[model samples]
Target: EIESIANHYGWQIIEQEIDKDHIHILIRYSPKWSILEIVRLLKQLTTYRMWQKHEVYLCRHFWKERTFWSDGYFSCSIGNVSKEIIQKYIQEQGR
Candidate 1:
């Protein structure tokens, strides 16, 4: 469902994985998009989709506030960086 909204807006997901309590998605798009905007779109649209599945979590957490994700998200530049290098960097973060 998240993919639907993203793809609709022309955002491409390069990789994705789910951990116990969170999700990690590697995305790519043209230079016109901003990481913050993409993250906002993901959380908002995904929250909408989650309701359809009768699932709700951090939406109500005191600390989650209005963001399904934290106030900040991890992002990096793909410019001049190989996919292998990017993958290794994200992997080494131990996420």
Candidate 2:
């Protein structure tokens, strides 16, 4: 799902890692899209799809609220760092 979203917007997802409770994605996005917009799109679409596929199981945990991801997110630029280093870091998450 995330890959599809990235593809739709022409964002390059260099690497990604999904943990039980969170995800790490190393994505290269266009300057036209703000981080807020990207985060909103990801959480909104992924939450909707997840609910569609696993409503029964999700309802058990999120019965009181229709929330999947947390309200806050963490994002940062690679800055002067190497892309491969970040990709390796993302890949090693949750292991």
Candidate 3:
């Protein structure tokens, strides 16, 4: 899902790893890339896919609400951290 979003916006994924509850991926792209637009498209696509595939489950969970996601997401950049450090951190999680 994340990869698709990043790819649609011409972002490059340098590294990726998945944890129990979250995913960590290092992505880069042209300076003109709009983070907001990318995020919006991702959320929309995921929501649509989930709705189509999990309609019954979703309806059972909450008929009043229609959002698969809680609200927002977390994002940050590593300014001083080296690529090796980040890769090691992600790798260590797998062990």
Find the candidate with the highest lDDT and give its number. Answer: 2
Q: Is candidate 1 or candidate 3 better by TM-score?
A: 3
Better by TM-score, candidate 3 or 2: 2
Judged by lDDT against the true structure, how good is candidate 1?
0.70
lDDT of 3 by residue, 1-95 (tens): 66777777788888878777666666676868666665667778877888898999999986896776656767667689987898778766644
Location of the lowest summed lDDT over 10 successive residues in candidate 1: 58-67
- Pairs that collide, model 3: none
Candidate 2, residues 1-95, lDDT tens digits: the string is 99998999889888999999889999998899999999999999989999999999999999997778999999999999999999999989999
Comparison by lDDT, 1 against 2, better one: 2
Per-candidate total of colliding backbone pairs: 0, 0, 0
After superposition, the stretches of candidate 2 with alpha carbons farther than 4 Å from their true spots are none
TM-score versus the correct structure, for each prediction = 0.68, 0.93, 0.70
Ranking by TM-score, best first?
Answer: 2, 3, 1
lDDT of 3 at 23: 62
